[model samples]
Target chain A: MSDAPGVLTHAAVMTGRSLRISRRNLDAMITAMMLPIMLMLIFVYFFGGAIETGTAYDSYVMYVVPGVLLLCAGFGSATTAVAVSEDMKGGIIDRLRSLDVGGAPVLAGHVVASTVRNLVSTTLVFGVALLIGFRPAASLGGWLAVAGVLLAYIVALSWISAAIGLLARTPEAAGGFTFFMSFLPYPSSAFVPVDSMPGWLHGFADHQPITPAIEALRGLLLAQPVGNAPWIALAWAAGILAVAIGLSGVLFRIRTA
Target chain B: MPETMIEAHGLTKSYGKPSDPVRVLDGLGLQVPRGEVFALLGPNGAGKTTTVRILATLTTADSGTARVAGFDVVADRHRVRRAISLTGQFAAVDATQTGEENLRMTARLTGLSRSHAKHRAAELLERFGLTEAARRQVRTYSGGMRRRLDLAAGLVGSPEPGVFFLDEPTTGLDPRSRRELWQVVRDLADGGATVLLTTQYLEEADRLADHIAVLNGGRAVAEGSPETLKARFPGHRLDLVLTGREAYLRLAARAVHHSPGTLTLGLPTDGTAAHARALLDEIDPHRTDVERFSVHSASLDDVFLALTGETAEEAAGETTGETTEPTEEPTHV
Candidate 1:
């Protein structure tokens, strides 16, 4: 009874607490879902006709939805950062730390909550894409694979955002950092093909993590030639997840210390 | 002596960059026996919160050692955390969650079974007089209600040999709310728990604390029972309120100390009925007729002033500056 609770049990309880906050917080919910949907609308209606894809605008929808999904996941994960910073600033973190429950639960809770939140936002973005005449060519198994890839990406990005949130002095600063992070996919294959960029940007766009993730999703959805992109995406996601977990753990120790 | 539930020796802590650091605690030491209400009294920046943080295992000390419930604070932090409950300076209850949710969550994290956690939340909500507000969001709670909920949240698991750490628990509470909280703290002590609270008000310490430790400049300046601290100052004082402005002015000329604003005069006495009577008789009745008079013994307020060289009001004002206020400033105690 004196021991700290089992990590998963404590994390589940912590996650339940965070999810309750998310459910009650209308402002956060609206902000998380609205931004990606709006982006999808503006990108499709405004930029869809003008942008060049090998096929027509209907085919272009297939290309952009994957990118949009990734962007939605990225944006949704940023909210976790804001939530973490707010918790750190509040007396809640101190109270939790002082309790026998321990610190990992706090981190685990945010990561779990944010991952679930990203899942919802990702689903919403995908649904909206479908509404706007987008269709995927993937089989049922491919769609499941798409979900697995997206979950990994969401978990990885959420942990990184948690680190940012813990380190930021204020909620405003955390929001600003994550807002800046949302721009990361722009130079990659998110909105446009990596080859369309200039030489310097193209090199970076191809080599970075988002391009490979987008490439993997696009290959899966369009029934295009499935290549090394899926494996590369998995490697990148796992690596990022490892780094984020380590960095955030260190930051948590320093903060509570 | 009762078994010491908490002990600290030569604890030190600092914040900010190492090149230009701000020392919050310096060679601080303490001992608190089980079932005693011990108060750490200090002004702002005196490290009262820092000391509590160290003992509760929320912050590490730069040097020295601290133990709570016979477990080292540094080496056995989880064990110490298991033995204690902390109600910090800020109301730690989640603003978005209902009062019951906050309490229930705390119980679950502390390892209660789901049914037990729910039961504990219900029991605490009733005990804190928050049963009516249990389902209402905490954001809607009044300050006093929120503070009581925070206190209840800390007690969710009801750890055995309860070691309660309250850092300025009633700083912003109204007089009535403050008294209610004091009764709760007294009851905890009576239930055989070790209670250590920090505060800036001399009256709060006098009312609730079994022993008061005066912390000034991050170190203990004085430590003793409230009665013993008062005894160190000794004797009593005679106070007189004059009839009018003219009388006050006249008295000011003859009296050693007189204030025009209050129109009162103060003189030290040997704290005897005979001395008070003789002093009153010695004063001329016609020149400055006495409106009222009273004799009072020394108080903890005077002891704080003599030992720390700061009035309780000034100490409270300093705290208001350093605190990151969660809401509008609470009316000072």
Candidate 2:
């Protein structure tokens, strides 16, 4: 037989497979894209007036848009867990492994697809926020930084979800395992300010990774001082990316074994 | 290449708690020559799947060694993998993708160029009678169609004769589908690919395999050609179907074998009409208790029963004490 395919080629082909599956799952795609948008509208129109931000911004959409973007990542990445879990539960994993395909390519495919799905929904959320009178005063550099930070977070979260998918026994259980990730944003700076939350809640809201990520996005978009929030956000993303990638490798071996 | 396309020796694997492990494979050994179809016949939890998995490089045996296509399964796994295709018990095709897509993706993963993969996919789809359903999602296909597609997927990268592992390839298929798959398997071996298949059906092994291994308690109790195995239980037998259950019970002591389900009693004979008549007369002189009687030679079923001390059907209905391989969960289809 001809030389076996390289790892990169396998990853690319698997990525194509994942993307095709994502495209055909219209119900899931629509839910992933629309959930953040619906949440954005509810906060901006329904809950925006009742809540007050300590910032100088006039419209609540400006402060809430970044948090919704992070929410979009959470919801989009959870699908990665279900997709990976489905592959593991089926006979396809054994088929692929028998064909000489390694776990890295198979898991990478899901993470990359998750990132692409999150990006689309993030852009859609941004557009909907703009339509609802949200305006940003950031320069080009700030926009690039925001994109970099969001991409890092989305990719990192997707890997974490992939690891969870490997750990779970079924697709439903994998989806359930990701619930805490989707809810992380809510307890952080996604909605109201940390100070506005109860005293006991401030510890988690201030110290968690989601709060720094949202803080970095809010500061960048509003042209305010971000201090070390962007670096902290990127560090969190990098740390999670490392841990998740390593954990996914271990989990993949364990599950497949 | 070695004449033996697949070989395993003293293979052992166990699962469960460390203190109380359940041995799935205990000193199992197999040798399949080139271009031959070898069948591992056993009931559930007989370690047939485990043996195939070890040889296919999906799972490693806890002890011993296996070589597939002249490469060690554990050390040279990539080489072994490149030289083998495994069609697992479950149909492994992606439900969301079309049949064509599933085949093409497998082709791509196996190192085919994009155009070549497409051409190969279409060729296999046509060959497997799935061309009409090529573009339809696999989720919409019937079980038989899915199995054909799954088999087609495994063949995508195999242009040359190589080791092929089919784990219960026709387990849940209808009779027609099973026969069709048998022909396909025969064609595969006829074309020079060494095939190692596992099955619970004695007839499947008898009909298809050049050599059959009867596995029980994680070891092969008997191994030979169908005819050779049948020769072990040589001689014809008079099979008598009694008129009533009471009559069957009355003559049950005189019979060599009796089946409660059919009220049939089997009495050994010398394959002579006179001997068959004499035995029948001695058992039921008036012929009022006898429904019918027929003289038949021993079959693989009889050989299996003789070797394992249990009818194949009975063995299938219950789990053996030494085997605890977890039953596969039902696929979502």
Listed in order, each prediction's TM-score against the native is 0.88, 0.89
Candidate 2 per-residue lDDT, tens place, B120-195, comes to 9999999899999999999999888888899989888865687899999999999888988998898888889999
**lDDT (10s digit) by residue, model 2, range A1-257:** 55689999999999999999999998998998899999998898899999989657777888899999999999999999999999999889999998889999999998998898888888988888888888998999999999999999999999999999999999999999999999999989888988888999999889999999999999999999999999999999999999999999999999878
The regions of model 2 sitting more than 4 angstroms off are B232-255, B259-264, B267-289, B292-305, B310-333
In model 1, state the lDDT of residue A122: 83
Candidate 2 clashing pairs?
A: none
How many angstroms is residue A233 displaced in model 2 relative to the true structure, after the best TM-score fit?
0.6
lDDT of each: 0.82, 0.88
Candidate 1 Cα deviation (angstroms), residue A31: 1.5
Candidate 1: residue A2 Cα off by (Å): 6.3
Interface RMSD of each: 1.6, 1.1
